[model samples]
Target: MDALVGFTGPPSETLLRSMIATLMHRGKAPGEVFLQSNHASLARLQLSDDHAVGLRLDRRGLIDGDVTLLVCGFLTRDGTESPGGSVALSGLIAEYRARGVAALARLQGAAIVAIADETAGALHVARIGAGVRTVFYGRYTDPSAATSRWLVASEPKAITSAPAFQAAIRPAAIAQYLAFSFVPGSGTMLQDVFELPAGHAVTLSADGSSNLTNLFPFEDGEWDGRGDGDDHSHWVAESRRVIADAVARRLPVGEPVGIFLSGGLDSSIVAAEVARQHNHRVLTYAIHFGKHYPNELQFARSVADRLGTEHHEVMVNPRQFAPRLRQMIWHLDDPIGDPITQPNFELARRVSQDVRYVFNGEGGDPLFGGPKNLPMMMQHWYGVPREPGFREKAYLASYRRAYEEWSRVLHPRIRDQIDPERDLESILAPFFQQTSVRSFLNKLMAINIRLKGAHLILPKVERMLAASGLTPLAPLFDEELIRLSFQMPPRMKLRSGDEKWVLKRAYEDDLPREVIERPKSGMRVPVHFWFRGEMRRLAKKTLASRHVREAELFDPDRIRQLLRYDIEEGAGRYGMRLWMLMTFELWRRVVVDRDRTGVSGGR
Candidate 1:
């Protein structure tokens, strides 16, 4: 399951066999599963009987010629056939073959998909837009577009592992990772290799000509003329139906499941639905970062008590954070700056003990517009002047402060890439110019869908699969759920500074209003306080290490200055900067520097 099939050109029969051997875990099929092209570089997967239908090009309406394409990932929006994925993909492929041109459509599931058309002498590779499945492609010779060699893979580590290419760091992405605590867009921690953007696809012609295309076009669909009818309950009832259906489908019978209950609105909604439908008590897990971070035990216990389910909570310590920090860096494949990764990794480690399946509230932000961005969004939407309105001005002021703070801490090379003047253009410049209010909201959705959502859910899921063979079920990440959020009016999303206002109303009967109305408190890790206290020495030692200072990518002097200031001032601003540097150093040591001895803890 860890191994992914991708190469530069068409492979020999022996090479095809070797690729199949790498996937030794997949069981034997009734018919042939793996298919490769002698003329074109292509491979096809036959994971199930339905997948067999997708593997058969003859049955497919496309030219009925020999084209070996590996269709990875699920496409569920087309219909409801359990894994309605292969059906949607096959239909699109047949449509393209018949038209002999580009075929663009919205695919609901997370996948790293590649298709080769031998007859047309072209190949197409893509990651599902809002990229649930990881896809990476890079160049061997030059970083230029023409000299690039493309490889769409599921794991960043797999692409990094290619012996032919030296995995170098992208400093700009590293800076962004520090600021947002997650990499934005298609860029990853590794140089040149990019995660294909959500709602976008890249096509490589058989003649070696390449073009990247955006599949989902943003349209400002609205109902301004029509009144809301003031029926909030309708929105609530419909959301319940959609969420309940989505969860029920993902859970396989006779299997013990786990829910990452944060006692927040989103997870509470999921827990409520699970209790209503599922026969067994869904094993619920929570994370605590000592007393410094907000403790959700009391809130989570209330939800657990109401649902009559078993719950588990793991209190993480500094020692656990240090080791698991290195472990997550390895599994995450990309460098994400978020400290929440520590709590998530710890949660997965503990959850693996009780169950093999876990559900988390990843898509909640994008779906319901969680409290993080609500204050600013509400002010602007209601036509409040940016400088005069209290909420609007306060929000803009905070953003400007964050930008200035980030600018000061960032390395010059990274600072050069981002324009501070453009950065301060009222914060809504990017949203207004390119995307509609709805479309801009989708950008936030797209960000979480690609970065924060992927960072929080996928890495833990990957470790669970690698260690205990657990499968994570994220219903919020479901295609139907995303589409629902997109379709819902923005007014319902953040009314009166309440984040996830629509979600709360929808689950009102199922969840206590107190639980829904309470300020949002997801899993929190006290990395800032930790860096200033018990782990202070560890932080200093790691930043000052020879390996870190000598890493070819970063500026040694700049690194030293930032570390010195943070240690002396005890400001958490430098803690973020240090975490980004430390994660990169750890990644370089574990993933890139294999033969070294002192590669354990950076300090």
Candidate 2:
């Protein structure tokens, strides 16, 4: 629930103080520091327990005699830290000693660790895993030294606002944003502000030299995820235990809590486990879109009634979209094209009034596989013109819009500027390479974990929940459960055309068989269908508005054509595409045009 920011320069007390003020725009700012020699500055936010934030660990720490570390996220330590006890960066160095940075592997939670060595005047930064918590670094300069300085922060605004890095939009990042509906890879919209991808680390020297490191490289080794034997029951039993423990640890100590029960297998399973472990009727919340959309209220309520839990439900409509769109994007710095984001936002807002922690089945699909995965795998294997990157493009193209369609979607000017295949490979290739000596299913899962989860899903949840003043705990995304998930053979993940086969089996008796066996159509938000009818005027006005034209980020004629087709012959078919365009326009208005009021309301 907290963010961290730091700079290494002839410390401008002004900049340090400004960063603290700007950081407050995201969360509470209770921490700030600057070395007397004007070498470093730091700021941190400690969120209250009411937000239901997980791993309530402090960020500013001194590593014994070696380094000072500013940690943005939490670390699932080997043992307790004196019951909410926090260790200084120096204390960690003293505790772990020579092991020092190597002990970071013991970290099971999300974190962006920015460590500065006092003895050596050197710095090291790393991200713990593939979670929403991220660090963006960019080089700025101190006029006095004529040397390069750097700014790092959990949010890009902290770094991008500085004179050194904030200039204009990065075209390549815009191209990727236009392509994937969000900025992917290391690049952000700001040309100089680069995100540090998960499982990677960077080292900086006082002399202005730096190098990047990959914490977990497949080349170093491979984990087959083999258990004691080929026994299916043994694997299922282990899956249950690991997932159960992950869920249990995430719940609040003695405060009210709830699970986002969509009655889908993942949330249902999480709810059932909470009931089993806590021996109480856990509070559950589910989003109920009105009729004409796919509603899982019956399934969700059935699970709730069967578990004997306090149940709460909230409804959403297309009318709420206009006001919340910018606020949602503001919450999510990088706009996720998914329409369900707003619904989750409202769900978090409403549920926060009743519970501090809200657990959801967010990572289940990426780990255990999901329905949409099978077709992508098929396309990857069966795609024609199978060049070096075609399979990767076909499999990982989240937009699912054909490359041939790009010319018509984006203008020839914008479309020609981007090399779709090249962009796809740039983002997908690195993770795909890690699949060496692994199953194809595992390969896809790993790619999704590194790409989709890290970029789209996890960040969306993290920001929206924070904006709603609630913490999101995805047990399925728990560090150990994710690692354990990889160990299971692909067959267990997607077996005989059944997605999450092993997970379904693990929860068969505990959850209703109908719920477990039902074909998974994950939380369908009827936005596409509504856009064709109820939301059409709003969609058209937003997509074809003058503000969008002023931005000139897209082609007007192409947008008109798409809108015409979607409104006429296409109907709800291109619903996802329409939503993406609308989302980008809204984001452009807010982030580029400085439309703060567009993002006014939030927790």
Candidate 3:
């Protein structure tokens, strides 16, 4: 992966060089630069990635006077690629003359840019969308240097590479990760560092002050009330147009692109659009569990055959799945406890041999709404949410594990550090209390959109794909498409019990009725079956490792129940919980213990 990391205070050539050296191991490229300015030291590493277009811009960081500007990730303005031709920070400043960060914030795509200017006496950073691409920053006091320094990096592992930086796993974040499978909101595993919110810009002044600017999130009390009564057919047409535009914008120019064909409505819609654009000669990839596995390779084959595309399939099993944990967890800098994560990794690894970029249809569920949300919404309509007892029960209904389950598994000292009820309430508060979100369905969608898609799914896929020497793009995550989703009324999102109603209607003509009507069983990995077989030994050994035992995160007896084949509870799903715990322990060993072989940082 290409690297971009810098600090606004103090000059340390060693620190910047250390970061650049780390990027070399991830991929091979010569887009490297090192400059030590009077006020700060900066380093930028832009590796060879064909899937993303803006690395050339990153490679050409502007060194105008006392300022150094470095950009990472891709950007587009009003659906048009930015810095159109031979443009740089100096060019932007000369043209716009107002720092240009405001214009950067206005750009709509997945991007993060950092500019450090001594003349301006402040460092500026901006992210394009909600956590699809973002910056993680922190301020720590370095008494040894007799100065306090604030820093930012693409990943937390980069910050840990600097001198005086020690990696410590935050217990509160651990509790959230254990309960939700992902730490929510701004929290990270590190103590003083937190991710800069998506669609925001941060300016850290040389005088030791920082300020933030909101770029993409909907304002509190925000409501368009525009699509409240639009005609159904018209809305469907509009939805199709919006989705198509989003996909087209993300397609890399002069780069070979492939589509992830899953035989589901969202993926089929994406594949059909690619086919229409390419005159039916497309490169498509799919993954299955072989004959004994419950997979939809047949349906995927049907879609590919109808489109007349060259389709390739990767058959994955327990043996391949269990062995890649160390590297897979390392790529996923943050622990995301999803069972499908492994398949996403293996698919990207297999696909990278031929393609530079692969597009997957991911945002349809959260944006257009999806099935399996009916049960969650039932509580919202039929039960009283404000009641203290009811709220806790409802929250747990959505969470993976409960305190009772943890009580048996966690050390008392570790268990006492967290309050699950309060933590979960804080994360869900934004949606529950927003007066503008009138529909129960929108509230549910909002929670999932913010946490599930942004924090959990996107990070895992993006990083893992990059780790495999390929770039991953989710066109469905475009800001324009996401904004259009909010414009549609809730009824169109989940009409009656038919979830993602508008999405199905939009592509009904292009895709088969059976594919559109099928229930959302989503890429099922045989996690349960694996746990019953080969994965059982791996899970047991990892959970009982010396580092994990010394950390005292779990009880030996509770670990025993998980290690044994038969186990189930209201506390957690046997396979899923074991996965979460196993992943967490592995993360602590790799990230917390600073094991160099396990994790690849901007060293």
Candidate 4:
């Protein structure tokens, strides 16, 4: 992953170098700086060849006169033209010079772009469609110069590198993380430091004023006019065509590609397409806990054998990677409580040795339907006691994270600062209240794609893979595929009870019968067993430490109850809550506490 980091003020070579040091793990190349009269920008070169996907060197210039353009990820044209081909970086800069922020609408794919306009006295940073790439920005007054400055980076650690930037924990984001297991919307766990949302851009002027704009709006009714009338085959054919084109656009030329096959529908579909299209050898990787635990290797092996792919399997356990926990969380920049984060990071470490680009079936669940929505749909139709804010409550509870226990787990001082309505529910209110999307199911889909997909799923994957110096390709989350999903009738996605029906129908013949028909039991990380067995000692020591107690975040009694599994209501489900507490506590030490020693390997 290539990155750009700088501020909107007089050139400070020292500050630029400090920010660059924070992101050196992203790339080993020397950092390049472009200094101007009003602003300065620094870009780190990519380790892999940009021309692997037809991206020429001239098109991706770091500086262009009064305007400096810096891109973090690759951009591709819509399938109406070349499938995986990239739009020239030079062309994007030219468009920005002419049309300003409006030119962003023409850009597609998973990338983030930052433009510094010395002539206009303004700097702009935008995240392209579906947010596969992330850009975080914050505005603070430079204490030395007494002038306003905006610090931006690909990861939060870069912004925190500046000595003048004071980093503090944001309590409201803590509440949100407990509910969704990841921070939702533009706000991050760091106070005043915000993440740019998907299809959004932020502009900063010389005087420190800022403006945020949504370049690509996610409204529904726009797709109502499209789609063939009730003809199942039409949707099947169209879905197959659109998905195939997406996969084609992401395949790197003349290099072996890797697929993270879970034997699930999403990864299987991606593997099948990659195997069918790539002329070079296709490699597939899968993980299992051990022989004692339930595994998906049989199904994944079936897919690999059918496609004749060179398959490799790896085993991950708590003891093997516990020492690297702090390093993994530091790489995440923000805390994501998913138990699979370690596995994803470890898998990428192995995959990077063989391939530069890896593809997975990430968007299938959020875009099309997956089994996670079934519980919410059931509660929507037949839950008891329809009270106010029932939908929001039901949706939050569906995550099965710490939503129900958030208040109990938090210390009173910390809990008092958070309001469920203003902080948590407000994030979902706009999507649910909007009448533009008619169907109830589509509303849930909108929430899933916008909140979970952008904030959690995509960012988690990008950070994990990027940490190991590998670029991730998610064709299912393509802009064209996203639009095509909305045009599809909701029933077409969740037919009767089967999820992702259209996807299955599209590639029924290409996959094995067992693979296609088997219900989606995702790669379930055994957190519960680990808490009682392998990770038990580590969890107990970390959660009960003096640092955790003095921070006044979690109640000591509640932590004891969770460790003891004494709570009757959530018995046998305390592992997830303990994991969330452990992740946040560890993240707080490295990020907010500024404990550099903890980042390498925690005790």
- Give a tens-digit lDDT track for model 4, residues 1-603: 677676888877677777777876764444454444457554545554545753223355457788888766677654334654556767778888789898887778777778888888888888988888888888766677777788888888888878677889889989999999999998999888988888889998888788888877655433574556578798899899988888887788888889999999899999989999999989999999999799999999999999999999999999888888889989998765898988989999999889888898999998888999999878767878476677888789888999998999998988999999898888888878888887677888888888888888888998898787788889988877888888878888998889999999998899999999999998888888888999999988888847667999888889888888788997767888888888888888888877766464221
Model 3 lDDT, full chain set: 0.70
lDDT of each: 0.57, 0.68, 0.70, 0.82
Model 1 lDDT tens row, 254-325: 656789888887788888887787776588877787776668888888887788778887788877667555
CA lDDT, candidate 4, residue 235: 84
Clashing pairs in 2: 51-471, 61-89, 62-88, 62-89, 62-90, 63-89, 63-90, 64-90, 64-91, 225-487
How far residue 2's Cα lies from its native spot in candidate 3, in Å, is: 3.3
- Scored by Cα lDDT, where does model 4 land? 0.82
TM-score of 1: 0.80
Q: In terms of lDDT, which candidate is strongest?
A: 4
Off by over 4 Å in 2: 25-38, 50-60, 63-66, 78-91, 95-100, 141-148, 163-167, 204-210, 217-229, 279-281, 379-385, 397-404, 433-435, 545-549, 566-572, 601-603
lDDT of 1 at 478: 67
The true-versus-predicted C-alpha distance at residue 87 of model 1, in Å, is 3.0
Following a full C-alpha superposition, what root-mean-square deviation does model 2 have from the true structure?
A: 3.6
Q: Local error of candidate 4 at 230, Å?
A: 1.7
TM-score per candidate: 0.80, 0.88, 0.90, 0.95
Which runs in model 3 stand beyond 4 Å of their true positions? 33-36, 49-60, 64-67, 79-103, 140-146, 205-211, 219-230, 279-281, 389-396, 399-404, 545-548, 565-572, 596-603
TM-score of predicted structure 3: 0.90
| Ranked candidates, highest TM-score first | 4, 3, 2, 1
